[model samples]
Target: MKSNQTYAITLVEYAYGPAFSNAMVYSGYYEMTGTTAVEYVIGVIEGPSGILLVDCGYDPQHEVAGRESRAQNHIKYQHPTKVLKKAGFNPEDVSGILLTHLHWDHADCLECFPNAKIYVQKDELFGWIETLSMPKEYNTLKVSVDICDIKECINALGEDRLVLLDGSVEDLFPGIDITVAPNGHSWAGSLITVNTKDGKYTFTGDTAYVKDNILGGRHDGVSMPNGYNCGSVKNVLITMQDILRLAQGDMNKVLISHDIGVWDCFESITTPEDDLRIAYVAK
Candidate 1:
């Protein structure tokens, strides 16, 4: 049986990255002029156990190799600790951290939370290891990943702070379950579902970048795949069907971490001093 408890989830924006080209966001969107600014966020899940985070924002001080250089307009608004405080919690208060994938933007800041146990998909790590083992000519396959970050995750495992799930998990923590979209966005993208007072809200971290990928393609009764990914497009569409099933065709119930439109669609609070915004997923 699944846990009946509910949690309050909030999304905290820590920084804003470079604008994403349309082709990079929407599959088959070949237009070059159209672009959209994306928000880098961390999902805060508060429940009976304590505060848990969906993905920790990256560390600006140590820019990892292979990551695209931040442009002049790229903003590092606030450190994760300060931003979390502005959002009403301390870094130390985070009891667990759920990583959607090991991309630099998502998993590089795990060290910030001293007391939290980190959870990641087992295959996500192995897939990167396999990529890293490939020949030099295949380097493009891992441009978005940071070897240092992967090493840090391995170190956490050695220290007993990391839990690698083989596949989808139920009641990972009370009211919080995890579902994987393997070979979709990354090696294994973990889509999180948190039960709330109103209903269940699913946090999609790169699995579905925008509304169209999950909600569009309705005429064909299938999902639209993102243009940018590290895996097969066919598998991406297949994985999206799982996300769509979880959402039950309701776009409002899906929380897309990278989409700025989420802020417009939900009740949000912005702290100018910290230069961060919090979108309430469930009150």
Candidate 2:
């Protein structure tokens, strides 16, 4: 794949926003709680020709901290500033954004990348408003960062920046593809497939909290919202079926947006000098 093109991938740390107490740990999600750790990250895909972000990490201020903060949108916005500087770039230097669902953590700071084009699942964007009422779409009150609500996106981005693509996707870039999985955590949930040196990596934004959920076959349309469960049992069934196909083991490797372990698949370098020798990132 390196021979196919010259590019770099950056996994910048953002907010570390979750609070895990006893009950959470007792329930087997000890990692989701306590002072152990929290992480919010966004993936930067850079080819010799372009710069694209996997998702927009959240805004960490208290005002946006309510439910949006539940997943612990782990962040250190300074991570962006620092990573960019070390890479000889800046926030404004980003040229494109591929929003993975509109949850605040993944969509809040889009304004920072004013010069980019934002790509998303077309159905996911429209579904945000219409699907909340559908049992299959699940309650999106918390996940809905619909294009219209952000106001900033509307005011600064205009509709062009928000291109919604639904269903199976073609080559999004030289080696990447966008496949919107309609399993119910949110209306237009998308799973991003990136063709990397190691293999194909699929980034699932909240489709599941941990890779096990996907391994457990959760995307079959029966997906339960993280920290909330508005999904229909019916949705879970279909999503599970979808995972079965992917799990076949060559098509892709699933990376959950909230999974701390899966992050290891990517290598993290403190400076640009570390360069693009690996496929994934980690803390």
Candidate 3:
């Protein structure tokens, strides 16, 4: 098993269109991939590292309010086993889990890989507490985000692998880095980068609802299409500062968790080294 083997990722799922409706005015958010599939990337890092998973999508068994809730749209999952099986992997075979942020969609499913180390932004675990009691004007969910999953992450990996690093620094890994681009999008949002062939791949987890938000370098504001607290221009700007650091252009590729246009950009082929990265399609 070569750790330096070509790293790969897959768009396990992609959702498009307006979501989190209540967030529209405040967030200035238009495109919402709310009820969408959870994207997972199966990477075969350097020698025998087995595999690393970033942002495990929602579990099929977990059910919430239907798409009508605006918060919960047409959420769908391709079954974790199916996604991993595509790469000849099983949950137990995974080595690590790096959750960009624990919004219900991203971190709730950690139990899937009970055997892997869970890495996250140290500040993000309780990042939402500050605004948990704020008024609706903040677009706050006030749903009392469950920390049980995070605790599970700590226990599974012995609290050692439950890593919390600077979201503004790099070198988290040989070809990896994360920046805490806080837009109050969902808790302490983060921007992830995976260095690839020539440049790096940017994973903007819900920090922005769509690709244009980061690509164009503009905060579309906070959107709560889900009846939660819609975001504000000021907070979104703070998030912008973090995302811009990652850069999403000639030098990088932007992966929006819910953008259908962004998702379609990648091929559907399955494998540990899935086709999810900066591409040079002819203009």
Index of the highest-lDDT prediction: 1
lDDT of each: 0.80, 0.55, 0.52
Instruction: Please give, for residues 46-113, the per-residue lDDT of candidate 2 as tens digits.
Output: 77547788887655453454455655443334434455555555777777888767766677777777
Cα-based lDDT at residue 122, candidate 3 = 65
Q: Which of 1 and 2 is ahead in TM-score?
A: 1
Candidate 1 per-residue C-alpha lDDT over 106-186 given as tens digits, one digit per residue, 9 for 90 to 100: 888888888898899999999999998899998878776888778888888888998999899998887888898788779
RMSD (Å) per prediction: 2.2, 6.2, 6.5
Model 1, which residues run further than 4 Å from truth? 65-73, 217-222
Q: Which is better, 1 or 2, measured by lDDT?
A: 1
Tell me the lDDT of model 1 at 145. Answer: 81
Q: What is the lDDT of residue 267 in candidate 2?
A: 55
Error of model 2, residue 147, in angstroms: 7.9
Question: Taking the tens digit of each residue's C-alpha lDDT, what string does model 3 give over 115-188?
Answer: 77887766666555555446777543644244445556667557466766555666466556667755455555
Cα RMSD, model 1: 2.2
Winner by TM-score: 1
TM-score of each: 0.92, 0.71, 0.68
**Best to worst by lDDT, what's the order?**
1, 2, 3
